[model samples]
Target: MTSLAAPAATYAEAKDVARRLVEARLAARPLAGIPGPLPDTLDQAYQIQDAAIALWPDEIAGWKVGRVPAAPGEEASSERLAGPIFRRQVRQATPGETPFPVLVGGFAAVEAEFVIRLGADAPAGKVDWSLDEAAALVAAWHIGVETAGSPMAEINAIGGVAVAGDFGNNAGVILGPEVPGWRERPLDSMACEVTIDGRRIGTGTAASIPGGPLESLVFLLGHCAGRGLPLRAGALVATGAATGVHDIVSGQSSVVSFGALGAIACRAEPARPFALGTLAP
Candidate 1:
């Protein structure tokens, strides 16, 4: 039988793979595949993620985390995956921010999530922080929408490893008001619903997110440190979607309700090309 061995890994190889995806994202073009084989492991996938972030000139606005679903009959993993959110793409909508721009001809989805804004840095180089320690770093939490998109339409077809390779399939974040007494609330018990153009699409809770938000933050803090991407103070970390991911298209409006927390509404418009420097402050 012929040998079936994978090629050795290198940062250069990883960066090259990331470069193609980055270019496609910037130009709003779809990508077929990485130049070579896709990253096979989570570590390799994160390497590509870091490389891709380096290629982008925009400032890091925040990070988004998502659960990696376990296989059938297997216990769920405590670990979570992350992606960077560029500053230019972060939006603050009070009660009526309408017509958000979602890229047409791309992998686009919306997720209703609880977002945490960090008050203290969970400095890099430490790997054993507890959930309470991580929660202490949070300054505030908000109900928000995570605009998930990618240049690779087939990204999810390959699994979480591939999604992690491309900025966790994150494109932007739509921030809402801060949640009062968020710490006192039972996040896992809170329910969230997602709708598009007045039609209900999905409903879920923090329990749907592996380990809940605080645990997800703990996982992110350690994961980022291990991957050399530190969790900085003032960064917004949108925890995994409370409501399941729902498909969206340009020209449609989306509304996400988090029960007593409140609702966020935004319409999607076709993406228009613009200079990153102009958008970045």
Candidate 2:
């Protein structure tokens, strides 16, 4: 087996490395013995995850989710796919207008999603919020693209120390048009497709998400709360992909179509290959 990268040399160094990369929107390079495979709880997961982003001195946008079940669609309930998004990246921006500098790589994948922008406060009271309750607070809904490099074999294989060193598998997000029906729309019945150079690559149904969108919010609410973050009204939550995963590479443009709702497109820009250790700074 390929042995995992050494953990950070110390707790402080691990925190600093994670912070530097997150804030700078750079890659993660951990020191030996720092990022150990021991932070098992969701709370611990966010501490490392959040702190990395916290290193950025910008206003946090919202949250991104993955590993949600794909039921009544195609998943066999065994392979749980997941990743993260910068809170700020989840905003209701124009299709091509975004502040983050997107690095271009041909290995891009577009996933269609319904975005839920919070319209109310999600206090961490002892009550279990219902799906409808979570939906009621939506400010708007839009189609989007969640892209990353081709699934790295190491990232797909390891979930702890290794994932941390990879910047939480985040690449970029593109927001499309806002739906009018918003919260009242039935997401499960919605369908979408992934297109590369105008060719259909994959198709998916919203029902792939176990309980649809609110289910994603429920999971996200707790994930943030566990990290001491209250769900603010302006936050946007991406439910998950509507179509199957689509992979792409550089010099190519990709788009995800969710039928009449709308489609988000991103043209990949070339990125220079950075040596593994280049992320250390």
Candidate 3:
């Protein structure tokens, strides 16, 4: 088992790093090295993540789950990581609504995702949740796009620990229409395709997400419980990308189709400028 205890010195350093990136926004550059010391384990990484969340001063609108490729000889069951998505950055769009704004130079990318909106609170302290129990918490599901961005440009290259340290590289989310009676749908077998500017960019299914969406929720439930993060009612949880991540630029249009389940389309625009006081918890 991994140790959950992280040094106090390291925690403070991680918090400062997150504060600088949050304040810098699109202007923040990738660090050549994390100050104090780099986190060497998932527990340490999440410690940095929790500290960073405290510094952001915004209500968490949702969370984005991403699979961390398992290390050689590591079990597949232990390969998921999560990050927060602030409420100010979450947006909802219909098939032909206005485009979503995302940071242009700030590690912008798009991912086709399966998103669940929780109906009941999954309070902290309970860590053992079955896939069915996790699924029962979902109020609805949607075909959506996660606007992936990070203040640090080299976050992806730095690995999952770094990714977790900076809100899991999430910038924004575009929610499409809810899939009514989603409980009856066969999510794992559903096909999804992403197209940008009318050209196909990627294709995949829920099967690509480790253990599928419900199981991913189970992992997240346990993770947040362990970290003392509350999973409140109405919070949106986006399962990992189905179609692979695709680079996107400001002013580009994207369309994600989840076969007969539904489709969502939106264009991306340059992020608006904001002062530090704009974000609040």
Candidate topping lDDT: 1
Comparing 2 and 3 by lDDT, which wins? Answer: 3
Worst 10 residues of 1 by lDDT: 272-281
| TM-score of each predicted structure versus truth | 0.89, 0.73, 0.86
| Candidate 3 wrong stretches, greater than 4 Å | 1-9, 26-37, 69-78, 277-281
Put down candidate 3 lDDT per residue, 1-281, tens digits, no spaces.
22223354366676665666666563433333344455777677777778777777578988999877344476544478899989987888664844776665566778999898999999679899998889888898887889887755556665677677778878878887787777776766677999999999899997788678888788889988887876889989899889887887888888888888778887888777565453332
Candidate 1 residues lying further than 4 Å off, grouped into runs, are 1-9, 69-79, 276-281
Ranking of all predicted structures according to TM-score, beginning with the best and ending with the worst: 1, 3, 2
Which 10-residue span in candidate 2 carries the lowest summed lDDT?
A: 26-35
Tens-place lDDT per residue, model 2, 107-225, is 24456676667888888642356776766667776677665532243343444333434334556566677777755566655778877788888887777766776787876676566
TM-score-best of 1 and 3: 1
On TM-score, the leading prediction is: 1
- State the RMSD for candidate 1: 4.2
Candidate 2 structure, TM-score to reference: 0.73
lDDT: worst 10-residue window of model 3: 1-10
RMSD (Å) per prediction: 4.2, 5.5, 4.7
Clashing pairs in 1: 99-267
Q: What would the per-residue lDDT of candidate 1 be over residues 121-193, giving only the tens digit for each residue?
A: 7777987789889988999988889998887665665567778888998989999888898778776667799
